[model samples]
Target: MERFLAISPKSQLWLFHTALALNILGMVLTDMWEPMVVGAIVTTYLSIDATVRVRYVLPMKKVLRELEQENASLRRKMADVEQSSAY
Candidate 1:
């Protein structure tokens, strides 16, 4: 098992593909068809959430905080710019 989550979009897709392939392969090998398709979708979605939690969720919290701060900064700048630009 990989210890790190995939951060790049390319890796994200590959992870999903890999998950689906594995799920399908396991199901087909066992001669289960209906469950295989459903399992593939479930595993793909779970893989996305799992990848996000492992890779970006924590860092995204901090990014949200930073963006909140930047929002205020931008608002202040916009106010000044608008005031100056007002005819």
Candidate 2:
């Protein structure tokens, strides 16, 4: 699960779609469908989870980056103020 989450979301979605296709093929072409069904289920879950997590995380990442930029600017301003006061 951790390893699945660690993979890129694009790759995860692609893998899920591939697994689904294979599952459908297996159902039509093979007597052995159990493994493919299981694979489809697992890949589907991973894809959904990765997409949802990425959706939640991206906005937070942007917000954190903005906050860091603001913090740096404030620090610079504080340094300038301190220097003027010393003079």
Candidate 3:
């Protein structure tokens, strides 16, 4: 389940595009609206999810990681200073 949920942004975008293409094709070939509507809904969802991850979520995660690392370094430095001052 974890592995299935771990698809990359690029792959997700590809899926969105594929679904859109198929939806168009299905509509053209079948002259039906139901499957196209369903596909559109799925494509919309994938597009939103991919956009959020690419534009906001992934960058925020990177920023958080950097902040965490900086915090750890500052803590280490503070500890060193405290230890040195104890003499």
Candidate 4:
């Protein structure tokens, strides 16, 4: 649906909650318990996983890259100090 497609990652969680509510309503209306429950559980897991990756994992990756760069610079500085001390 265009509505679903228009949802951004930041707003995806709101959509997930909406979808979850809708799923439960639909299941109740249709009297299909087992399949709908399974679908809801799976969707919840995947949505939470995506949210964590977007909200935490990606930023952590950037932080990791920055730390690596700082570490390399420190190593270079240490090497320079060692060389100067030996002179």
The TM-scores, one per candidate, come to 0.42, 0.60, 0.78, 0.68
Full-model lDDT for every candidate: 0.77, 0.76, 0.79, 0.77
Weakest ten-residue segment in model 1 by summed lDDT: 1-10
Clashing pairs in 2: none
Q: Please write out the lDDT profile of model 3 over residues 1-87, one tens digit for every residue.
A: 112367777687677778777887887888788968888788877777776777788789999999999999999999999999998
User: Which candidate number has the best TM-score?
Assistant: 3
lDDT of 4 by residue, 1-87 (tens): 123456565577666766777777878898889989987887686577657766887688899999999999999999999999999
Candidate 1 global CA lDDT score: 0.77
Give candidates' CA RMSD values in order.
7.8, 3.6, 2.5, 5.2
lDDT of 3: 0.79
Candidate 1 local lDDT, 14-61, one digit each (tens): 677688879988886888878888988898886776567647775787
Worst 10 residues of 3 by lDDT: 1-10
Could you give candidate 2's per-residue lDDT for residues 1-87 as a string of tens digits? 346557676677677767777777877898777877787787677667766656776667889999999999999999999999999
TM-score of 3: 0.78
- Residue 24 shift from truth in candidate 4, angstroms: 3.5
Which should have the higher lDDT, number 2 or number 4? Answer: 4
Ranked candidates (TM-score, high to low): 3, 4, 2, 1
